[model samples]
Target chain A: MNRGFIYDTFNVVQQNKIMLVYQGEFNQDIAKSVLAMTERNLDFFGEDVSVKRKIFNVMVECLQNICKHAEHSDARLREAIFMIGMDKDTYFVTTGNHIANEHVVGLRSKLQEINQLDKEGLKKMYKGLVSNDKGLSEKGGAGLGLVDLARKSGEKLLYDFSAVDHCDTSFYSLLIKISKNKIIQ
Target chain B: MENLTIKATDDTPEVSFDTSGVMILSGRSLPEDAASFYNPLLQWLSDYGKSGVTNPVVFDMKLEYFNTASSKMLLDLFNELESVAKSGVDALVRWYYPEGDDDMQEAGEEYAELVEIRFEMLTY
Candidate 1:
C-alpha cells in the first residue's frame, strides 16, 4: 500500500463530507461503538429525526452483514470497511468485506433481485420470507437484510465485486442511499 | 409462567411479559448473536402457550430499529402467538411507530399481513 495513496484517500473522504469510516474486524463491541459514534455525529449535524433513524437502521444492517458474512481467512481478510457520508440531501451507507468467490454469484443475484423490486414488491417479499419456515440461512440470515435496506432507503442497492490476489475470495462492497426529500413520500 | 423482563441495552430491546397477558418490547434490537438473545424469549413464549392463558393477551411492540436476524426471531414470536390465538386465547398486537416514521409503520403493517392474529397500528 502506498502511503501517499492513503493520505490522498483521506483528503478525498474529508472533502466529500464523509461522516464515519472504519476498517477493522467487526464484532459486537465494535458495532456498538460505531453505532454510538454515528448517532452522535448525526445529532451534531442536526439531521431530521426520521432521517437519522433511517440512516441508523441502514447502518445496523450493513454492520451486521459484515459481521455475519465477511469471509474469515488471514487477519486482513477478517477486517471489513464501512463508511457513511452525505452529498446534498442524500445519505449514503457503504460497507465492504471479503467473501468467498464461490458465494459471489448467489450474493450478486440476491442484490439484483432486491434491486428489481418496488416498495410494494419488497414488502411482499419480506412478509413471504418472514413467514417461510425455512427462510433462515445457515448463517442465521433471513436473507431479507438487502431487501429491507432497499425498502427503507427507497433507492436501488448499488454493489461491486473484485477478486483478491492469490486467493479464492473477493472484496464485496454494497452501497445504500437514503434521500431526505423522497423519504416523506 | 412467571413474568419475564429483560432490560434494554445498546443493541437489544427491553422485553416485559406479564402473567396478566400484557407484553411489551421496545428499543433497538441489533444483537450480535441473535439466537443467544432471542432463544430464551422464544422459550418463554412457548411456555406461555401451554400455561392455559385464556385471558386477552396484548402485545405492544415499540421498536426503533432491528437487524435482519432479530426480524426472523420476531417472526417466530409472532407465529407462536398466532398459534395461541388460534387455540381460543384472545390475542391482540399493537404495533407502535414514531410519528412520521413511515418505514417503521410499514414494518408493522407487513408483520400484520403475515400472521393471522389481530394487529393495530398506533402512532406516538
Candidate 2:
C-alpha cells in the first residue's frame, strides 16, 4: 500500500495531514533528522498547538527509545525505523526497531501488563514504579516510557513482534493514537 | 568558589549552582544529547564532593519533560550526588515540579528512592 493513501484514508475531516517515516541507523544523526522532519511535517500539515506539543512529546520518547534501546550492534542492518502520521480523527505515532530474541519475552510481558491496566491502575503503577528505589536494569530502565505513552493515549497500546531474520533479530512496532477532539485547533 | 550559571533555552535548561552555601540546579532540562549536556554537570558535582563543603548542597530540578536517555543521565547525576552524601557532605536535592504535573513529582520521587541523599519534592 502506498504511504500517501494510508495517510489520506485517515484524513477524513482534516484538510491536511502530518506524516513522517524514516528507516536508518538509530544514532544521533538520525535522531536529529527525524526531529527536523517531524517539525517540517507538522508545519506542512497545519498541525494545531496541542497536537504539536503532543506530537513533540511522543516523538521525543519514541526517538529516544530508538537511540537508547534499539539493538544497534548489528553491522549489517539499520537499528531502527519509525513513522508518525495524522488525520482528522487522531494523530498516529509508530516506531519499529530491532530487538534480540532474548528481549522479546520480557518486552511482551511489559506491553501486556500495560494493556491489562485500567487508566487508574496504570497511573498508580507509574507512580509506584517511580517511587520504588531500584536501579535501572537494561530492560526496566526504559520501561517507564512505555507506561507513560499508554497512559497519555488513554487507549490500548497497539504492538506487534515479528521475526526479521533467522537468528531472532525481531522487529518490534509500537503505535500511539491521539484523538483529534483533544487537540487545540 | 565561583557559581556556575547557564540560561535556559527551548532545548536546554538553565543551571545555577551556588558553591557558597546551597548548591542548586533550577530550570527545565530537556537537552538534545543527555550525555554531552550532563557530563560537565556530573563532573561539577563530583568536584563539589571533593571540595569538602559540609554545607547542604541544594539541587533544584524543575524539568518539564525529559527523554529516556536523559533519565539515564539523571540517574548518573544522582548516583554521583549520592556518593557525595556518603562522603558526609549534607546533600539535599530538591525537585521542583509545577503544580499538577504528576509526572515531574513522580520522577522526583523515583530519584529519591534510588539515591541515598536527602531528596525533597517541592511544588510551585
Candidate 3:
C-alpha cells in the first residue's frame, strides 16, 4: 500500500474534531466560504450558539484583515494561509500572510500594546477608538480588528514575523485562542 | 425625501430608511470594504437631517453579525442620527440581539454610551 503526500496531509488535518485550511488569494467570496464551512463544522460539533458566534466573529476579523492587508507586491506575497481547529474547550484560529517590511514595526507595536491589555482595557480601547473620529482609520483598519480579536477571544494575540529572502516583505502569522468556558465583560 | 433601501447580500446587511422615520439594518455585514458599503448610508442620514424630518426616527439594529470595520462605520451612522436629533428630531435606537447572546448585547450597550440618542435594548 503506497499512500501519497495528499493522503498524509489529509490524515494530518483529520486528526482533531476538524481542521480546515485554506492557502491562496483571500477575497470576500473566499472569506464567505471559510465562514460557512467553519460554521457547519461548529454546528456539527454541537457547539453552543454563543461560543460559535465568538469563533465566527474572530474568523470574520481575521479573514477581513487578510483580505484587506495581505500584500500582493510579488509572487511570494500572493499567498495567504488560514487554519482553524478545536480541541477540548479551546478553539484556535491561525493566519499567515505577507506584509511590507515598512509596516512591520508599527504593526508589531500595535500588537504588543493590545497584548498587554486585560479584558476591560481592550473594551475601553475599542470604545475610545469607535467614539473618536480620528481614532478609527478611514481605510477600515485602525487596529480595530485586532482589538476585537483580543476582546472576543479573551486571549493575548500570538504573532511572529519571518523575513522573506530577497524581498522587502515578511510573512506574518497570528494565532488566537478562544475558550468556550471563559466569559468576561 | 425618498427612502433608502438596500438589499442584503451574503457579505453585507439589508438597509432600510423610510421617509416615515423608520430605519432598519439586519443580517450579516462583512463587506470587503465596509466604508464603501456604509458611506452611502451615512450620506443618506446626512440628507435626512437636512430635510427637517418631523416624525421621530426609530432605528432598529437587528444585525446578526458585523465586522470591526462595519462597527466603526455604524458608529458614524449613529452619530449622524444624533446630529439630526440635536436639531430637534426625536430619534431612538432599538438594539435587538438574540437571547443569550451577550456579545451582541454588550455591543449595543457600548454603542449606547457613544451616542447622544437614547437606546432601547431588546431581545429577539
Candidate with the greatest lDDT versus the true structure: 3
Between candidates 2 and 3, the one scoring higher on lDDT is 3
C-alpha lDDT score of every prediction, in listed order: 0.87, 0.72, 0.89
- Higher-scoring candidate on DockQ, 2 or 3: 3
Ten residues in sequence with the least summed lDDT for candidate 2 chain A: A134-143
- Interface RMSD values for the candidates, listed in order? 1.6, 4.7, 1.8
Task: Tell me the tens digit of each residue's lDDT in model 3 across B1-124.
Answer: 7999999999899999998999999999888778888999999999998997788999999999988878888999999999999989999999999998888999999999888999999999
Q: Tell me which of candidates 2 and 3 scores higher on TM-score.
A: 3
Best by DockQ: 1
Fnat of candidates, each listed: 0.72, 0.19, 0.72
DockQ score of candidate 1? 0.71
Tens-digit lDDT track of model 2 for A73-119: 56554457787766657888888887887999998999999999997
Tens-digit lDDT string for candidate 3 (A1-185): 56698888787888854579999999889999999999998889788888889999999999989988886767568789999988887899999999999999999999999999998899999998877766345456756889999998889999999999998899999999998778422
Candidate 3 DockQ vs. native = 0.68
TM-score of each: 0.94, 0.68, 0.93
Tens digit per residue, CA lDDT, model 1, A15-83? 977888999998778988898999998899887898888888888888888878876868889889999
Runs in model 2 lying further than 4 Å from the true structure: A1-18, A43-48, A72-76, A131-142, A165-167, A183-185, B5-12, B20-62, B72-124
Q: Candidate 1: which stretches are off by over 4 Å?
A: A1-9
Give the candidates in order of lDDT, highest first: 3, 1, 2
